[model samples]
Target chain A: MARMSTPPRGRPGRPVDPEIDSRVLSAALEVYSEVGWAGFTMNAVARRGGVGKAALYRRWPTRQDLFAAAINSLRTSGPVEITGSLYRDLTQTANRLINRFLGPHGMASIRALVDAKIYPDELGEALDYVRQSTIIGGRKIVLAAVDSGELPPDVSPSLIMDALAGTLVHRILLIPDTRRAQLAANPEPLVAQVVDLVLRGVGWQGTVSTRRTESGSGEPRTASEG
Target chain B: MARMSTPPRGRPGRPVDPEIDSRVLSAALEVYSEVGWAGFTMNAVARRGGVGKAALYRRWPTRQDLFAAAINSLRTSGPVEITGSLYRDLTQTANRLINRFLGPHGMASIRALVDAKIYPDELGEALDYVRQSTIIGGRKIVLAAVDSGELPPDVSPSLIMDALAGTLVHRILLIPDTRRAQLAANPEPLVAQVVDLVLRGVGWQGTVSTRRTESGSGEPRTASEG
Candidate 1:
């Protein structure tokens, strides 16, 4: 029995501890939010995570490696399964996207990532991975809608992704005081309006769900006129 | 006896020498492009401009002041005259935008500006001014279309601005080898498509002028179906 002690490395499922990995990653984000990318270091991350420097080093050989792993950990469950019409799916996804941006971490994290791109190669690679992974789930939902004929087949993924995310990011970066409550207050109506606008632009044949009123004049919106 | 002497400020309506100021600004952009914002200095700019350091100091009090001056010198023009239709006006403007980006200074200046924002307060202020100036003309063109019943009045101006400019920026930033040629190659069709998409989203009542296909699918589009 004394001779039967097995090393942790030899076990099939013990390659890396998922729980410790998540802790390390979250700690990295915490440090980033405090000191920004320039100030972030592997040593600071280890201190934040309450892990030994050696353990942190064993997992992530470089700062970018740690950052990219941290980003992967932040990614939530996929496909935004809201069952209904195309409008419903788009509206739900848009709301989720806005909410995620408005969360506790907020847009500073994103700005930090963009700022990081100005430096060495690892940061660029890590930022790209973070950006792409963040967008991939939303894209999957849009693609799913297209497959079901909820959206036009020829509509571009790139255009939609850029427009929606870019507009949100612009708001976050320029206006420092915006809060999650403000963002979520009436997102449904705006989301509904945008979804209709985009669906129509993409050449979908459907009833325009959100009728818009003229600016200043606030003209009455009547779908029957069109 | 009073000695008749031209004031040290120089001739009226030409108080300062344009040649030196212009030279300094141009040289600053050159240095910024090569060494980036962190390395750019007033002394280096003065040397590049072939002006005495004292003259440069006399004009610009600080690095920020010089950077702001240089950014302010960049030219931006027009609420491009509408061509009786949204399609023509939008496509014409898009082409002009592409030309500005692809021209002599082109993308390097933009990259410098983007990099600048990460560091200094002066750069941030300069960026704000530049961003506002760049979008003003475009906004006016879109507003004109709205007045002409080409787009819905309810569309958020800021959101629209972000979408148009941000889409272009995102493409340039994310894609490794994106070129102005790639954008301008079939500028007319792409612009027309985006215009139609925007118009439809905004609840504009107009005839679809072109039969453009969706990106992945080759099917010709008809407004009636949309």
Candidate 2:
């Protein structure tokens, strides 16, 4: 939990255990992903995590609070590190996104995104944390590339990042279950393919050697055909 | 709803009302969008559409059947007319996708996508229909463009379509509700910017006049600055 260490305001002596918070929050994401906002309840989360209802509520008073914390917690867990090169940075980021989306809590993410959009009046803030997870890091990479002369100044970070994220997601959405195992095993090639295309699209001119996928050319990334 | 006329296998004599099926399916999408798979109950859909549970169950025996049918029904509802010219066709299709994503049931579509990804056993086929609605038409346009000398023969349609879709969806996901009206009102400019960048990336060489967004340069498409 993002606030596991910081005790609740004006309330003293609440036991602060990172283990319980971590366990509960992880369970929160699992529950949210499985049941979504509609079916999300403190009892369900507590039951799933095997924590007491009091412990769950002590951390997050409401279901929405718990849901948002789970999403925001993404910032702390499994972050996609950013080095400088546009090609390498984007490839790394896309690889992380592909792997995460193919992970267990991916459904909760979808539900959160949908809930945020459909019920913006209620769930809009949920998207803020979600955006922070990838959009913030992605925009920084694009901006840094521009500053480093890899990309032009006139380009919109929104446009470039969207293109990258959009393509990755579209590929995920379109590929069937039959190909899923192969994709999960080899996200590098597909990530590289998308990054290269977007970099080319946005007019990035990197040296041939630093290009992404070819670096991960080991394993059954089979048929560098395209 | 996608098949109102066809009788159930070996189970006939059930009254067929296209009107009810349409209303019910429409409601199903709306309900599903608002409350995803977990909260998606036939009773909720029946109540939302004002149709009895018996009517819904009779037409479609299961929730998944109703859900899948609703997604597939998109094929008949909004056929993005595919004339020639890759640039024009993609812009039109992007425009439709943007508008639809901004529309009421867009959340449902997002849920369906996430559900399909997270629970392939349960929802993978939902994506097939979603892909057919956009991917099939997009590919046909790209293929036609390639054959007509507008694009190089070697360009992967998957790369191109993913670029287009990924960009649009990413934009939608990133923007807050505040700008949604402006985007929905004039998806043309944003659509054009994406199409132009992608087309340039893929090396499509259509003349300037045939470019998409400039045609919608009317009203506050504001400062055609991009």
The prediction achieving the highest lDDT against the true structure is 2
**CAPRI class of candidate 2:** medium
Per-residue lDDT of candidate 2, residues B37-148 (tens digit): 7788889999999988887888878887888777665445354544545666777777767766777666667678877766677766556666655566677778767876
Question: What TM-score does structure 1 among the candidates reach?
Answer: 0.63
TM-score of each: 0.63, 0.82
- lDDT for position A172 in model 2: 78
Pairs that collide in candidate 1 are A197-B201
Against the true structure, whose DockQ is highest?
A: 2
**A1-226 per-residue lDDT for model 1 (tens digits):** 2221221122123328888977887888777654455566899999999999988878877676666666544545444553434555566666766666566444334534444434535456555555555456457656755765667777777666655554455444443232435645755654554565566666665443422222443454232200
List where candidate 2 sits over 4 angstroms from the true fold. A1-15, A77-82, A208-226, B1-15, B77-80, B208-226
Residue B108 displacement (Å), model 2 = 1.4
lDDT of model 2 at position A137: 60
lDDT of 1 by residue, B1-226 (tens): 0111111122224318878888888888666544455557888898888988888877876777777666555554544665656566666765665565445444444544444334534466556555555455556655555555555555555555554554445444443333435765655555555655665656666565522222223322211201
Please give the DockQ score of every candidate, comma-separated.
0.20, 0.56
